[model samples]
Target: MNITHRVSLLCAALPLLSGCALVVNAAPASTATAAPVFEQWRETQHRGGDDLMTAGLGLEGLRASVAPVFSSPALPTADEARRRAIWSSWRGIADLTPGGGFGDRYGSVQSAPGREFSAYARIPGARHPHRVLVQIPDNFDPARRCLVATASSGSRGIYGAIPVAGSWGLAHGCAVAFTDKGAGSDYYDLDAKSGFQADGTPATHGALAFVPEAGTAAHGVAFKHAHSGDNPEADWGRHLVQAVQFGLQALDRAYPQSAPFTSANTRTLGVGVSNGGGAVLRAAEIEGDWFDAMVAGEPNVSIAGAPPLYDFVTQAALLMPCALLAIDDLPQPPVQAQARPLWTQQCAALKANGLVQGDDTDAQAQSARQQLANAGLSDGALRAGAFSTGFDLWRAIAVTYASAYGGFAAGQHPCAYTFSAVGADGKPGAATPEARASWWSEASGIPPGSGVVLVDGNAAHVADDPLRGLRCLHALGTGDSAEAKRVRAGIAKAAANKPRAGLPIVVIHGIDDGLVPSSMTSDRYVPQARAAGAQIAYWRVTNAQHFDSLLAFPDYRKRYVPLLPYMFAAMDQVWAHLEDPTRGLPQDALIETTPRADAPLQPAQLSIPVVSSR
Candidate 1:
């Protein structure tokens, strides 16, 4: 069968083999009826009520259940004065200095029988302080050098690093370290009269701040200081790199005689997922000599690489409004009136412009084929499928856009433009007149009838037609303000993916990823990296979503839980290839894996036939 046909068949069987029910059931429970069986199982696990011992295995299950009851004794702590001196010794080091040379900066160090040494280091930066944790094996010896992996934490914060990759590094006899780059604590102190205010208050501590209103200077000030600011050099990515470097320094200082740690080797790797993944890739590109290999799963690398198509601010403006309307359970009449027309108009525009049409038409099928072809998925026999249909595209835009909006408007990082009419019961409700007026008046400057529409008050909200918003934002070009220009430049610099020559990098992404589209990697990063002469391997998993691995929901957990091992295995291969030139890394491969209830998950890999990119 041709590649197109193969892809179609894979797509058809995805729901069954890859657990489509999980995605279908991903939405919040609408009715009061108990959640699906899998969801219930997940809840049980969360509450510590599930009997793991009997659920999947026999003796092993019992051991798993009882294992946590036995607690290990705590290790001794290091002297506070000595720890301070150790860190003070390296106070003026440049942020990008590479390798392990300053481990003594760790404030606390304790060693267990098998776990060896676990230490925490606090590295202060201009914007915020970085907290890094390092783990060393009990058998660590100065004469025998070991691999060191600097892991980046995902969106949930620094605690997520060890579970994602650090534990695996430790098990493989590699020292593992991670830094919390102030994700949880980093914020602008709104009440601090000036940027230099020492109130120590976090940016997220109070009411949501305005983004960039013209007349409101307070809003602009908050926007400038918020975590996502106009300064690229001071952003989170820059801080992460510095933290990683500091963590490495602490490792070397702690083990000063350990082979005089110098260069990247099979023993030095960088690993992360999502935001963390992006950090890893950015660090590799900026500090090329620090790591021999890197593994980035669903890295957020397209903000700059893909240009107008994937910039975060543009995406928020274009997609979030429409998404908010679609998911609101009890939207007001005005909201529905505004949103429905916007959706219909955009769909009509798409059809009229030949961007989408009925799936049966030859022209439409060819168009669909061409688009997929760009992502290296065209097969002669494969016809334009559901995605090409105007109706399908409409539905997709609503669902995916809504999801994106929900994430963007989440309480953790609310923007001034993001407004939600959520009811006391935690469900979306109609907007009050006052709420509607607040946002509408502020947005009055938006061109009238230009896709951006205000629909309600008090609980009011804004809805932007997706396609129109995209075009409008693209035209805006990050606004005319100096700060806006800085923000744009910072994004471009941070998102650049120019890896140094000969570095082994493996990027793995799920084809169905909703948040950061998989094409960002398969179609953009891979080709760009190849063009740069970097030794890179790309793995495209059949059915996976952005939060699949991190969420405890049954379907998501099941589909992605088993894939971690394969990802690590791929990293190992990439590292090996860096060490041995003759060894080859797999490229354009399809990895299939099943989550096991009885044992550890394993993946079976297959080589995908090469196809020309459009």
Candidate 2:
């Protein structure tokens, strides 16, 4: 039977098995205009009717609501059946490590005598194994099966899995499972090496490796490429797909029928934040049969293409530095003055390195070059001089951070300063191939023909507008080749497709999220799903930052922690709809809240307007 038919059958059977209330609400009707829905939702909220959470509730209120559900008794028949189904499909390719710990670490329940264990699943084509942490509840029953929530981590690695697993999965009486998804390091290592060898070379058994351009400063920072697996499995999309598929299989194997896991009664749910959020979405699209429900918070669904690359460079070179400097108590004027001279020097260095062939008159170009050279010493010398004299503290810190995160060496870093120039509109301008080349050469101090391969000029996409030119460098050999074709197909297969008819999906994003812009969801994903007639709910939270609520940012924690219970409760409602089809799909609306640390989660109404893709 088809997926929708199967889901309908399951829903129909649910009533017979447990007297479950099947609420068959009609699908949301299509509208010609979008603004009315937003207004209507606002009206509803203002009316003070029953929503997910009541108005004026505080932390104590949140705890009171959540405690009971988590502490409830098990459904033995359902749990046992679910556990059995999971093990029946197990591949047994993973090894389970015993767990012993206490208290909360990274948001997971601290188990004394360790209820949590690590299962390492070996990927068929990759060198590194995928790691899944399974946290079993205290009240374990061998005869009962439990719900499973598989969480994926963000770019920062498995630490991103803690908040959701703790607040949502564990608290909801479900077994919380998390995967490293192959990128196990704290940072995205361009070099395959993550775990170090005693002899100092990258350990041969590290994550898969991706090839980097030889002449770039980003090269040789590590021992191996963790993303480059054998051929078709090399890309991240396929890795995540494998991680989810085998992660479940491994879990079934680890908790056998004789133990507490019975797949027959179990239902799988997927949840993730940031990159992990993207993984869950992709997994649902690729393997809808595997997951009954999913929640993705601020998922990075789009690839690292031209637009994102541009944003990445601009944020690193201009936006981030300014923010960091401000936090350091540096005045804007002096910092701007320091930055201008540094930018000029970088432009001159690029010209000198034969990277920029001046198209202007020889005299004009020469005068411009002289003017820039005379502005001040290069950024590297300035930073060194500042550190030595204890001057320009903000610039020093800004440059250091920019270099570290932008994947370049500190001092005379090209990528850090190459795109710092402002255009007529006062935004950062794009760096040309020659400029990028100059920056790389200066940073590495390597000559043009000295065995280092430089990026081709064509690869540096030039646009009429400098802002348009801002893009991250694309992966080498990402087009037309056999491997490239395979990677593209894999990514397309795993991307969020037109949602299925009955499967309910709730996507929550922060309006003020700096990392993955909310527009990607509100503008792209939601509209596509809506157009395709999928049961989708999109929540745009006002004034919420990307990492807020999930991470321990003191300001965000105060404002966002109280909202977690409500958010999870909404998700639970969606899951209920999946099983009974009576709970109705969640309404798409804007979640409004004051920025105050003590403010409650007061969701106002706003509809996602359908806009044509840019």
Candidate 3:
């Protein structure tokens, strides 16, 4: 529909703000050229017969009827405010320690006796230390077989690893601690910032974490809302590296008790979704010594490529906003072909506006032409190829988050928190007009790391290369650009040396995903890992989204008897892997159960709602 018509329809559907008072005049005799005939209701006379007009009730009386529920309290302490702010913002799995401990020291285990907590630690430049949670079961016997089952988090919860953690303790009978790897709200505290700087804004603390306030434990720092000013390298690559390291650390701390596998000698596995899938690859590469098997579901590893994040952005930029509002509106092949230019325009827009940031601008897109030429493309073809792969993920952000329950629509605008520049007022600034001039503007680029600039992107997404460039310019000036490049080069060098693997890794990805493109994982990532000789086991969930595969099947509980050997056997595989170092992958099983009669299956619908206002 046209904008005017749609707006009018929307306005008509909405309830009016308030009723307006109506004024009427009494019937009067007028000249033919004057006013038309008018009719009015009779007025009652109060003292005599009964002629009186009842006035409409005023808002004054209505105002006194309702009472406020919350009362303003005294100003909170800096510490209290920080805690409450953190707590209120907390989503997903909170603290997932093995046998909970109070504070300070890694105290003796009181609950999960032999279990150990593996922490994914991230200490960005000048920021406070924040870690993702990973736990391992006690491995009293070193030779037991094990399986690393990596899990993705639910759409509204922390990383699905928490379920792995809980199940390991109860049903699985395994030593496992899932990762709260993403800087999103699930498991980490992205807001765990260092004190404020002279500008009064929270200093470069940790990068962005994920969002949603559903759970208790804080995962990694919510990088989605993080400022590039503080963290020059805000790319997911660095976070992935950190995730690998954190998984290793958790294994190291748990040692013989939880993880019996010798880092230098034993096998390991990996797994996860979108962010988790990215981490799964990194874990296999960066911690190759620890991961022997791995799997990824709808991973968004390469922003520039045909990953879910890439496709989502591509579709959003080109297609109309309401196109994907309903499932039936999914774009067909012809529509997808039309969106290609929109994605290209988005990249051009980012570059023209210098929206790309940080020091790593020279990595992929920075030298796309030269790289393409080296890879055997002619200048014109190279340029075309470069344009084809540029990463402009802004559309992806809007597409992934515009719905309810997603953090962007929720109070914690994770994407805006990370991308938009922050003003002196502590409020994040809006995107430049130039950036927003086109409906297909590129979103913010990933941040750089100590040595690495951007993490994942392609030549087509040229603008993502400089996501942190403006921040760097604002903070360090033009001279820092070269320095930033050098730093990224160094980081790449370092990351190359520390290839992921060497830890227990398990990946679970669905074959059919509507949001995330499953082909990316099954085709690109898994094969790449195998080519690299990554010690990872992958489980392909036949049909599901990036989120649904991680949930425990309720039907499994209803139909099967409790404590079945197969159930225990499945649990044992997970437990053994968490504790010991033996090569094996979890058996992929379709959750068995009966659907309720009240809620009959709808083939046209993906029963689980992806977006929600509540």
Candidate 4:
């Protein structure tokens, strides 16, 4: 497992280049050699009926309402878990359907039969092991060696970025490397005193992906990101580096004669979305040019100057529901507007609590909107809060990240929040047989996904609302308590080191991304990068937002375009740049995309520019 075995130095000129000069295999580029403690490794071949990218489900199966069934409900096979995970991941991440240019135009479902090697590898200090999977396409060309390393978006499991990153890499005959980045669907069942074994089946002990501390007072269920007590975000960059190292090592092992495929000769690109995107950007800063280029789409990157995700998310969690009322005629209102009754009560609660001014819901709502606007929430971002408010995503995010930043043990979250399988009364309890069985396949690593839910202990009466939790979470960062200090310290560690000025980065963001707004994210990061003389390309897409899957809803489908089309375009252009140094980064452009307005998608709706290969 030592990464040092494959020392290579084919590119002698790299040592002379001013900006692109890197550790040209004189030594291992990362501390990955010291870690990646693999517990179990499994290799499988995919051909004909099943394949690497789709897991044999293809596009039609991906869109089906129900997931692939486990042969035995109680004891599902590892292959079943893999297929269902891929299916759920695709549904969670991609904006498929002809209306979004998914089926007929882009986001093709061609199968790539390949060999897959996956394992649970523990980082040097992390308690829970992260999942890493590498896919070597059957048609892989060793002479034209190419590798794409990707991270899971949000807290999604292993195949989270498969739709966008995996598909593109496989189609181009490149090896695809994936890492859950210290967070995945490796749930630990607290009540059963059990956790997931290597292949997603339950086990009482022995080399499990996660287990709560022996004496911790966890209630129902647990997952790594919230309970690992490692503040895994701090080491996200290392995770990406480890995945890349693992991939290269796996490739060398697979084709021994093809031998040492180091960064010196192989072209490696890193790409991802949301947290995955952030991981790639963070890796570019820390690792010694392991990647030749990177593309980050709607990434939730945190740095010294930009406010942390918890800071803004907590704010929106408190005010967004009430504020959403003031915005009139949102495209996706009906699905969320059912919460109007609760929103009115929330507005009244805010006024009584002195959080906002005015007696009536209208005035209170407007005041709440203004307050969020002051917190760097763009008009689109404020409007976009409707989805979060409806799903209560902000509340869940605030609690989950607070636990991470504080490095709390399992079930030790502030605001009395806990991860669990909730009963009908919204109380944490033991999981049902079915919930536990399918969790590895169905759950996103974040709670409120699949069977697991985020329970607010303070608000037993209001299961749908988490006002008390939001209040505590909002005040968490600034308070002088020991927990707050711990959170602050961890935040410092998690802040990404400013990328080297010469590193090539292409950042693609939607103008209306409410989850991680550009005003607070890309707008802040890009200028700092450019000021430092970084070779960065910025693409701003109109009528696009962070979550493409939301487009399946009738209203959302009409107003927004998927970001994947442009993400692919940027990848193509960046690949060209990497192929020939003369092809410079794409000029910063504001793409005016056409929304899917109750009609089949035309390539014209995407408005992809002719990326000249001059």
Which one wins on lDDT?
Answer: 4
TM-score of 4: 0.93
**What's the lDDT for residue 269 in model 4?**
90
Q: TM-score winner among the candidates?
A: 4
- For residues 316-418, write the lDDT of model 1, one tens digit per residue: 3333332232232321222345455554454444445455554333434344345444543323111111111212222222222222322222122212222
lDDT against true structure, model 2: 0.36
Report the C-alpha lDDT of model 2 over 54-86, residue by residue, as the tens digit.
111222222231221111122122222212212
Q: Which lDDT tens digits does candidate 4 get at residues 416-465? A: 88878866675667787667888888888888877788877787746445
| TM-score of each predicted structure versus truth | 0.51, 0.49, 0.40, 0.93
Candidate 1 lDDT trough over 10 residues, lowest sum: 38-47
**Residue 128 of model 2: what lDDT?**
38
lDDT of 1 at 590: 71
Per-candidate clashes, comma-separated: 20, 36, 115, 0
Ranking under TM-score, best-scoring first? 4, 1, 2, 3
CA shift at 444, candidate 2, in angstroms? 26
lDDT of 1: 0.38
**Which segments of candidate 3 are over 4 A away from where they belong?**
1-120, 123-128, 134-160, 165-182, 186-225, 228-269, 303-315, 318-507, 531-542, 549-614
